[model samples]
Target: MKKLLFLLSLFFVTSLYAQVEKVEPTFWWVGMKNPNLQLLVYGKDISKNQVSINYPGVKITKVNKVANPNYLFIDLSIDSLVAKAGKFNITFLQNNKKFATYQYELKAREQASANREGFNSGDVIYEIMPDRFVNGDTKNDFVKGYPDGTDRLNPDARHGGDIQGIINNLDYISSMGYTALWLTPVVENNASSTSYHGYATTDYYKVDPRHGSNELYKKLAEECKKRNIKLIIDYIVNHSGKDWWIYKDLPSNDWINNYPDMKICNFRGTTVFDPHKAEIDAKGMSDGWFAESMPDLNQRNPFLATYLIQNSIWWIEYAGLSGVRSDTHQYPDKQFVSEWAKQILAEYPHFNMVGEVWLNYPSMTSYWQKDAPNLDKYNSNLPTIMDFPLHNAIPTAFAEGDGWGDTGMNRLYDIFSQDFLMANPMNIMIFGDNHDTSRFYTLIKEDFKVYKLAMAFLLTTRGIPQMYAGTEALMTGVKGSGDGVMRKDFPGGWAEDKVSIFTRQGLTNDQIEALDYMKRIQNWRKSNEAVKYGTMTQFAPQNGVYVYFRIKGDKKVMVILNNNNDKQELQTIRFAECLGNHHSGTDIISGNALNWTNKIEVPTKSAMIIDLN
Candidate 1:
């Protein structure tokens, strides 16, 4: 399947002795839109040598020697149109004579890698924190040289879940009607503590040995492809682990935002777009370190910026990724991210990437989307942004009673009323909860009625929907308890566990009910095109009943939410515009046929997903 099989295995080029310590992206693919390739050559006195490449269609455009003599930024121009999948000898010279030869490779890309269609509205994303999902292999729980280890008893400690764990659960996920999968950062987070989240990247080119190898990660993308599941990788460009290899040996002080005396960030993400914000405040938010263990990257540095951009592209190509979830999207230098996204899109036009814009208002969140018409003329070039505004409104919307003055169902109406402020409303990434937030089940006080209502609205609403892991089994944890509690291990993930979500064993009554409800709606959503790509038509809420219609070419799905206590109805005439000539329909959730001649009786604190006939 590869033009050059040897190209797959990349090692340090040892000509007599090892001179090239690191080269990233370990390997590159030909036919890339960008013809230039900058190889970060690191070794002892490596910059003192002359860089020369003896291969057709590959030329050393410029070899830049940095302040650190061990580092050399070798720029090579590869003619994509003329370059074939082959190897070239990059000969390092001392006094015009070749001393060391490093064999660099340009491999053939997978067919249509550039044209890969990303995860969109049609796919329901099931997000997984790999370390807490399942422990398919316990052998690599504690790899030598990796300081952290797993402790199942401690919520804050690692639970030993790995890539093989996710590979083992693909069928269960696919069977549940989740069409796409998103794994929180699998890049090496070799920190001493709290590294399971994977946001603090240590080695960009290597996968954490405890989690799995790069080979297994590629196998995951391949396996997911076989199951018709699109894979999205969580990426963070704002910072890296404090113990990163490059950090130990600096090419320049500007490589990191704040070097020896690092200042902590205020986390005022709004300052990036705040027109009236003070320059000092903006500097504190952007240039300051996210945490003591994480070093903020200086995107203004051309070499560092290119490293971040190339790393993402390499992952996308190597792992066969469908989409990217840019973590801490608002924390980075806006201009660098814009160019980073621009270069990625330049290479792959159809590729989709969502940013975790953790803003509570649509007006602010919309500013990060690609085509947002901001007065500053700064476009993020991001395809989608997370719906934090709607997420903030959901728990309160379902918890309170109706007609309580913007307290109950009216909360949802108010949020949707501001959709006009969004750049692309349909492209929003909506979710009930994620690894960073409190469990959705815990937020609504474990109310089954509210659970069903939230799930129904999420699946049937506009934009792409993302479900956090273990939501089906009614997983409960508050964010204040610590991130590890909210991202607890699944019952079936460990061998010694009494309950198994896979086999439906040892689950509580409420958990069983929640699982059944989740399975039913998720599986039903797969085949329904109206709910996926259809236009949404929502009627103004009246009497605590919020009604919306998902209408495609000919298919229609009517979703009704009754947030009141008892039963309330007589709403046929109000929805006649979307109901059309159909007088009857079946509720997808209850599987009961209903009449809609004059009025329909709606139950309290429940949702009805009707398929009109």
Candidate 2:
């Protein structure tokens, strides 16, 4: 009898251990605006058990069991009665017998967490792809568990840039006058190969060990705070890497869209807003997988939706991030995307979130912004969007010579004229080029004149400006060749590189000129109120010259883009409405005084930024 009892006890313990395998969000915080918290519990036959929490001011509002016996979505109401910082026990009962017990923690939020300011028009964002930026920690280059390892020679392979690399080079970024650093997703992309871009996330909660630890990411945020630089994390909601733990053992069949047979996405962004679209096409666009290796998540599932929403909030609270850039924002279920944005903004009212809506038309992109006048009553609640239309127009604008109407410099003016469609035009993120596009330097055929013009226009424009890594050094690459070429490692990031643009060593005169010009404009933009919060007035392009002014309060900034092959004298009288009483202005680039009384002479294919005093 004694032996029988002992054996039974051992069996019970073993069964209990296997019953509760994982609890997502491992922990949460108290004092959140939303009292309701949902915890996703995964284990063998976990849903068969009843969950109860005995903590004060916390009540088990609901225990949701889906078709999958391995998962349980436990909802709790954590009111003000709970202690600011403490651990509570969650007991699982099956047939009135204790099945398992787990300890959950509630942490005190950092001061001013909810009020953290996000990146705005006043900020210039420098976007970096970690794996291609710099390799600061050699020790983490080849993490043992992850399938892919570092291979600097292979353009598509991971180059092993880590969080430390970014931390080490914060000074360089700050020196360039960037107020924010937006790195591509740092989440673990434990795929077999081609995982460096970080879009395919295998682990949503943990940072890639090869990049660094979660603590290191938090440290990076802290360091950035000390330098007055915001950190914007790239987040993907549409899909997860095939190797994701949840994908291997899904909580339910509906956890992923089209679970058994992954259907490739149509990549048609218009279906989301297509009033006359077919159901099949819409489903193909939303429910289809991003790639064979990336499984599209079914945000329609309530449990999964809550999980993703909580995950985003958890990261924001955990990492102290200023904002998030949602990757492939339009591919997800439109309603869920709206709810996700709403919840995030509710939690952090001042936090900013920019969605990557890579549509070529202003109408399509504007449809996703919050409060857009869509034909359908859908509001994404997204505060910001990438100005892809403007980005696409810039290269063509610089490439074309003086023309009759809406050509050359006029193309730029035409693009901005569509700003009325945007809910908040200044909130849009404008860029010359990004990691996914052909480098700006290469797009204009390496013409230094056009490059400077593009840069000046990007900085002085009416939206938040973002620049790709190595843009200041005139990095050149064509996306048609492959993304790796465009995302090449930054010089001086590696110790043995022959050229270190970081120190102005081994650089050509043109490269030096480009770097210095960018530095001058960006640094000056950092403190200029006119560029940050000014109202813009543009004149019709004439003789390949485009002129505009940014006026705020007593400050005024006039910009002239001369796209002609020869220097032209721009008639200043045409811009008198913006120039007001200003007769003279100081050129930010050349430090030369400009007499704007009648006309100003601008060099060919160059931009002149004048501070009207």
Candidate 3:
């Protein structure tokens, strides 16, 4: 009887022990890989009071704790480990008990963006603020401490669009013929209400939960590469969100710029180049917070600079992105920004990056472009810059008759004349409207004719063209335009929406025509290598008409835009000389044969593209 009772007790004890299972963390991430393989592992587990890591061959170099209590951080050194594209075994233990083992695969550094050798001069970038683009995943839309998104109907509030949303609509973007896509910052934006824009970054290393997980972001980049679509991530180095991790309890007092007592910048970019300017404005440009909610970063501080540089490199390596577009380019320390670009370009020789200068003057804009002969000698390694000077010219040109500043043709003539100021005029990003202003459609009063004219100029113009997300369908909204209006749910993105552009349902005849027109132009631009890397030459403006030729070797594309109210005739002789003796070709738009030898007639407020094949 005693032996039987003892056996039952032993059976019960074994069963209880089996029921208590150990759980391992779900998501794990590492960054800033050195040859020594220093890594910071971040993960979460339900009941991990203590954690330890184990790996064969590779050394367990260091371990640390992260802010979250559920997370256990581990570091490893792969110095002695040989690299081949294969998996290695790693284990995690808690309190002397085995919890989980992972098969960590190692490979040579992954390719971010495409091989950039021939990439710089040819690609047209389409910049989309991801949160405002689409809401593919509704499950993780609202996160705690961030905005509370109970209503998808409100644009001023969080709208649940995420990285998964962009991934879901890869086909839509690809079909539009855009070779590259640039998304606004996707890092963790924990601020509430207005965080949807993603400019106020609370965490640099983590993707915002409201947007999607880091893994999902990586997947988006991978999927884009498969479609031959390049990804350029927009980064904000000027300031961080008010409630940033470092702001709450900084690793050090100087971890942030002007820590404790926030500072306001003078917003004087000219001072950086001014011969006799006050030191106050120069300091303010580099150290002043963009807004009270955003804290400026001190790039002059070596530690802060190192942290930022490493963070950027980590993302490029991790996601394999094609390029980077720096936000508020002139706001940071000019010297530091130069070094930042230098370090990144050194690591990625073929990589291309463009900074947002937002300067409407040609001289101010040209100062940032690489190799520009600026009197200040600001040798910024950055290769490309946003061409606001050209952007400013387009609207005034298309708006009414050619008066004082209203001459539509004069805008282009005046702006292009200053092209000598640019280091590489072909590399400038030319666009009509962006997130900060009213939509192009709203700006032009929803006129398709005017819109198409703008499109023609952008597509055939001398710079890398970037069309804002809704520019195709004429998406419009005023800034502070209430977030909902700025990023209206895509026509057919949501199941509840009445129209879906994807299926061509619920679109009017004109809307459908406009859509088709965009599709045609984008597709045409994709294969025209001459337009991508061609040299442009222009003839002096004549009677409100402007003509230019994009030529590469034997291939030539002549663009003639007539902004006048009445049809104008070109004497053919003048443009003939600019075309290098070619007198006849086919009109790309109408498919009509062109008689460029004797004379050329262009309709009022219309443009013609001729493929001189």
Candidate 4:
């Protein structure tokens, strides 16, 4: 009798260990062969659970554990499971008592494939801060815990732009000939004020409930792909919001870059590549806070680095993005950054990524590009970078000049001189204004002619062009010295708005002309092969007039910019080499015959493009 009691006690203990409390499943491998499918599962009190998966014409090869202690990884190594995809039931048991049983459905991997097809591409990328673009849906304008509601009336507050709004305006973007869209961080920003920009990430895995959802972003990619438009997600690896989820309950002390206490950075970006830099300076730059609210990430921690890298990969595989735009490029650990870029590119070889190295100097910027000859000889695989050197110079050149120093068109002269540092100039994204700066119109004090001239050069330039939202509409909202006003909502996109550029609802004559001109130039850029991949040559500036030509095998485009207000005329013999033996051509803008000879005439404060056929 005592021996019988001992055996019964052993059986009871085994039964208690195998009884699972609840099974919570997370990621579903949308589409895989029924036989080869691997379903990762998370459960509460499931350590010793007896699990079995059953399906018609399908078999489970094994069950295992993932990195987490509370996971039951289900693996099916069937070769013919793709054809038999439908639904399968699994049961978890303890002794003879059933603990849990549920049906798991197998659906084709539509979302995963969407992410793969939508984001990888070779095209010009336009980055938009959705909240500042247009308000297509105002129903989601307000949420609890955040009092700054939709304020189309306030230029500094939420403008009510959402995913649906972006969807509504796809035609306008597509009409402009842009092949891809890179939106700023759109995850749920639960901050009390100024959360409209969506940069301060509160959660890494969850989409900011305000913008939409993880699924909506996938839908955005799907919508874009149908129209041949790729999506480039703007990612921030440098820091998170002050109240990030991990901040309250970190997995480990080293999970964050500079956790527990915030370390402010010196804003010294050059130190990352400086060979003689002090160890403390480098550490501060990588682990320092961008601002009081922004908590910097410490990528040096192995787990943190791996987590960030895997998260980035998950998004890429999840969203099917055409590319990625890394924010605060120099703030993260440089070694880890190299690994991040390498792993990302390794996963998707055709995918391209551009880093934001907001430096005004080319020498400082070139150190971040891939294969650049560095003092440290670091080989990074990041493919592209923002052209800040050129971006800054264009405005200065168009602005009324000092006639000396880095003034007048010489600003353009000095900026392009550094093009030799770039491995591929075509991949460089050139822009006049972005979400973080004063609008071009505001910067030039709303001068229409200056804005036109600036647009002409930006579209015809040698880099991938990125125009800020509302730039075409001549929207002039300045966000002050800190760039709070640079991003304003599009008129008439919301129900309360009075004007709409799409239908020309409330535009001035000048605004209409500007919008039409932008459409024309952008579409022209999309089709012009010479402009896309041609050799460029420029004649020296004369009285603020700069002339350049993009030449291919037999295709040549002569671009003439007149920053001065006075018009000038001359014979066309100056560009004989580039002009070839042709004596006549057509001005694309004016549609007038151009009698090529010793010199050519250009209008003052105007730009002309000559189509040499």
TM-score of each: 0.96, 0.96, 0.84, 0.83
lDDT of 2 by residue, 1-613 (tens): 9999999989987776666788888899988899899998988888888888888888899898888788888988888665457898788998988989888899989998999999999999999999988889999988888878988899988998999999998998998899999999999999989999999999889999999999999999999999999999999999999889889988778989987987999998899998899999999999999899889999998888998999999999998999999999999999999999999999999999999999999989999999998888899999999999999888888898767777788888998899999999999999989898998899989988888888999999899999999999999999999887668898887878888888888999999998889889999998899999898988878888888889899999999888888999876677778877788989999999877568888887788999988
RMSD of each: 4.0, 2.7, 6.2, 6.6
Per-candidate Cα lDDT values, in order, are: 0.89, 0.90, 0.74, 0.73
Cα lDDT of model 1 overall? 0.89
Worst 10 residues of 3 by lDDT: 23-32
Residue 304 of model 2: what lDDT?
Answer: 86
Off by over 4 Å in 2: 1-18
* Model 2 accuracy (lDDT, Cα): 0.90
lDDT string, candidate 1, 77-150, tens digits? 88877788988777788999776777778999999889999999999999999999999999999889888898
Ranking by lDDT: 2, 1, 3, 4
Which one is best on lDDT?
A: 2
lDDT of 4 by residue, 1-613 (tens): 9999999988866654444332322233333322344444445645456677666545677776534445565665544443354676677777956666656654445443432532321255667888877666666788777676877657557777888778888888898777789898887677777878877888777676667778988888889988888888888888888777555544356656566776789888888888899989988888788987887877876556655765676676666778888999988888888998997776666678889998988888888888887778897678888888887777667886537666788778777777788776667778888888878788778889988888888777687778777888888766564455556667767776678877889899999989888877777777677777777787767678788888778888888888887887745677777887877777766668877556677877888887776
- Quote the positional error of residue 198 for candidate 1 in Å: 0.9
In model 2, residue pairs whose N, Cα or C atoms come closer than 3 Å (at least 3 residues apart or on different chains), thus clashing, are none
Q: What TM-score quantifies how close candidate 3 is to the native fold?
A: 0.84
